[model samples]
Target: MKFFARIVAVLGGALIFFVGLGTAVFKSGLLGLVICLAAGAFVWWVFAQEREEYRGNIEALNRETGLNFKEAFGSGTTSMCIDETARKLALLEQGGAKHRLFGFEEIDDWELRWTEVSRNGSLSFQNVHFTFRTTQLEMPIFKVGVNSKLNGETWSQKLRLLMA
Candidate 1:
């Protein structure tokens, strides 16, 4: 499924780039090249793990959302919390399962702007920034596995499945 998603994203980016480039075949070819380059750059940035950002963070993160701090880290056993900007996330263990599950395998950015809550539901998941920030969204990487690499160092890498 994620492979299909990546294909779709690449195709969409290519379509825009080629459409812009097709215009250049008539002598605006430089602009078309630029369009394709920009699209490629954006795609790479979206999927690559900017791991340096994880430097020196807590094992048990103190997350903040539209919900306040104390409210954010409320009584949950094993749960996830996204940040206020919604660009990053952290999982919290409120004292329950001590399994080896690390974190979300998905690595792409998901943005939504159309989620509506009843405003009276139980306090569980942290509050989102907007009403729609949690609505209809998907990402490029859906499952990841930690592995020992050729260098003998363990790393978390995106899982790749081959469909016949």
Candidate 2:
């Protein structure tokens, strides 16, 4: 759903951009040029804002967790990190609106999980993630958002070794 929304947004922006460009080229005078420039500036501004927000969220998460993440992955609204020195894992979701932090010892079991999506009899799998099960809770972590069974298996093995 998020991906679809993003695609739609990109298409809309492209349409506006081309329309502005076409108008300027077809002798619509300064109005077309101004529209084109404005469209470009608006797009740039939106991207810059999103980047700033993402960076701020990451910095905030680091400060709140007080852990130096050695490795991080994913983008958009979710991020996964490993604080190897601290022997902890972190999952930041919803563009850092929510997060989870847990130690290796706290994980009782873990598995790579796949979510199946079906629409109009068409089947697809996505949002592959590692499911970490603790005595107190179970949650998905490291969402890669793809059908990566091999990748998941590899990570699962690595996690098993780490937990052991």
Candidate 3:
């Protein structure tokens, strides 16, 4: 949906640019040139604003998704965060539940935990594994993946899920 919106926006801007240019070149007034420049400026401003908004919008999405980041993976219940546990015990007990497997953070915000395995024939440089241990005893293990690139590719399981 966002992709489609972005395409439509680009096309609309292009149409405006070309129409402005056409009027400037073919019409017989200084106002036409002014209008063309104004149109170009408008498009530039819109794009610049959109560029900044893109980050905030993405962050909003991340937070929205992250609300269930822990629940999504079943690392902990919203309640009972455990009043006090040893640091090592807490880390061991919480497991990977603190991570959201489907949020934008899961897709974009991550530090790589490199493994010794890499497939020479595959573009995938790593297998992102998330293990969530929930207080619920058994919650469906939630996991998606981030690719090694910024283009937003994901792991094999995610590819299959997308296909399904």
Candidate 4:
């Protein structure tokens, strides 16, 4: 649903932009075209900045964990499996070639953080951070997302229960 909303937003923005361009071209000729072009360039630049920020976040996570994003989240090529009965959590990468596993006993601590983002004095969205510890690395394992607070808390509780 979130993905669909994003797609709709992008399409709507493009439609509005083209409509504005058409109106400008019909009115001011070459000058309008130049203005429309400038607007398009500005929009492109904004999207580029957003993409860079997302990429930087992934790079930072990779650097801290010494694992590629694909290896960590599987990126649709793998699956994350948790076995509470066995007290194990595993990240199964594509082709089953490289996998990571951690026993519950190895965890030192864990935390779930919820961050709220607002715009124009109104609530916008929420970000959830799930961080856990393991003796294999100096830094903790972290997973962050823009998911519902209820779902985040539920997952956090389940994981904590398993760890306990």
The prediction achieving the highest lDDT against the true structure is 2
Task: Between candidates 3 and 4, name the one with more favorable TM-score.
Answer: 4
Cα lDDT of model 4 by residue, 43-140, tens digit: 67656654464456445544555544431222222334465556666554332334566677777776666667888889754555556667767435
Residue pairs clashing, model 4: none
Candidate 1 residue-wise lDDT, 12-130, digit = tens: 87787777678678668888788778887766754452212221123223321232111122122333334333333343332312212222233323222222445667432222221
lDDT at 137, model 1: 47
Candidate 2 lDDT tens digits, 42-139: 66766676667667776787788787764355535666667777898777676556778878777677666777899999977676766656644465
Candidate 3 versus the native: TM-score?
A: 0.33
Which is the leading candidate under TM-score?
Answer: 2
Q: Give the local distance difference test score of model 1.
A: 0.36
Clashing pairs for predicted structure model 1, backbone only: 24-28, 112-133, 113-132, 114-132, 115-131, 115-132
TM-scores of all predicted structures: 0.28, 0.56, 0.33, 0.44
RMSD of 3: 13.3
Clashes of each: 6, 0, 1, 0
How far residue 69's Cα lies from its native spot in candidate 3, in Å, is 17
**Candidate 1: residue 139 lDDT (0-100):** 26
Task: Give candidate 1's total backbone clashes.
Answer: 6
lDDT of each: 0.36, 0.67, 0.39, 0.56
